[model samples]
Target: MSQMQQITAQGRQIEQDSFAIIDHEIERDHGGHSFSPEQWAVVRRAIHTSGDFEFAKLFHFSDGAVERGIEAIRNGAKIISDVNMIVTGLAPRRMQPFGVEAHCLISDPEVIAEATEQGSTRAKVAMQYAARLGWLDGGIIAIGNAPTALYEAMSLCQQGKINPALIIGLPVGFVKADESKRDLMATQLPYIACDGRKGGSPLVVAALHALMVEAAK
Candidate 1:
């Protein structure tokens, strides 16, 4: 076979093997859980991405969150991320079928100026920017790198400024990361979050891909 075919084959094999390991370990270690098959798919992807079985315990999904996420993706809802990492991590091939696109305003000139002027983090300012642009409505807000962004997104949702279909609040940090996720859970909005600070862009990407896969099915 050609070199390109060899590489593709290797990649596919690696993913399959990794998932097999994840499934075996989860079944052995975590015998039972409240997550449904669809919810377990998202948690399993997160474990595959992080190599941490702890994700199965840490992850929390509001009622019907997985269903809401899949419905939104099927309807071509926009995905708004806190940082560029999530935008970069998301697979275009997976999203393209639904005409879905991921966006991040953290590096925008306007967000920079406003954040600097208001003495706020770029992540927080980016959420405000998204609310102003009306992109938060019927969209998925994926925050995985900055806790401040998660906090701001929660505030916007509570204040009736934005109505995102689902919020993936898994920002990783030493400051307010756990607190922010707890705050997200307190609200009535549909959300998927890691209960502590053990989250990152990879988890957000994995969660979105899980939803996309479900939507496709």
Candidate 2:
């Protein structure tokens, strides 16, 4: 347990001489530090002015996560593994079910391209497929190193078209992570984020499952 908890459970002890000195110091300590009335009024007004919001139900997108999580949300599922299929016509496993009901954000459509295709041409072809379909309701762009993705997310929010319930910036490699994390926190939305790293597809998959379990209720 913590030191404060231990002290709370067991009374503090001190030598008699030291106790008198400490007691005087304690007595001089500020006891009534508080917000000013005007400050409190402003806080109250801000709370009152905030508006209502819709729940995302459950949401997630990963460059290479299992599509089982796709069914977690109402209409969305998971991106199709085959780029040519996506580019030509086939929908992602999770798209049709949740597409209209959710807004899906893809952070590094580039990443998907890199992993799923041979070169930029194929990737761009795949991207056009995604672009044409666009973000389903609860989807979000999730690049941890890129500020542009965060800006895209914010722009969507500002438009009042798509608001994400979860933004998971679980990017890989030796990239810096603080900026994306800060951006996620600033969104005031439900967020499950990872830092500069890799090698935890299971954890990412599990987080989506957890969101599904919670959102089910």
Q: Ten residues in a row with the worst lDDT in model 1?
A: 25-34
Model 2 Cα lDDT, one tens digit per residue, 1-217? 9998788556434333443443343336423213333222222221222210111111222322222233335444333211121122322332343552322223347556554665433322332343345542445333323333444445555676554434544333443345554565555554545433431223333344333433343
* Backbone clashes (count) for model 1: 0
For 1-217, candidate 1 gives per-residue lDDT tens digits of 9999999899989988998888787777778556899998999899888888888889999999999999999999999999899999999989999999899999999999999999999999999999999999999999998988988988898889999999999989889899989988988989999887789999999999999999999
Model 2 ranges with Cα > 4 A deviation: 1-134, 140-151, 159-161, 194-202, 213-217
Off by over 4 Å in 1: 1-6
TM-score of 2: 0.36
The clash count of every prediction, one per candidate, is: 0, 19
Cα TM-score per model: 0.94, 0.36
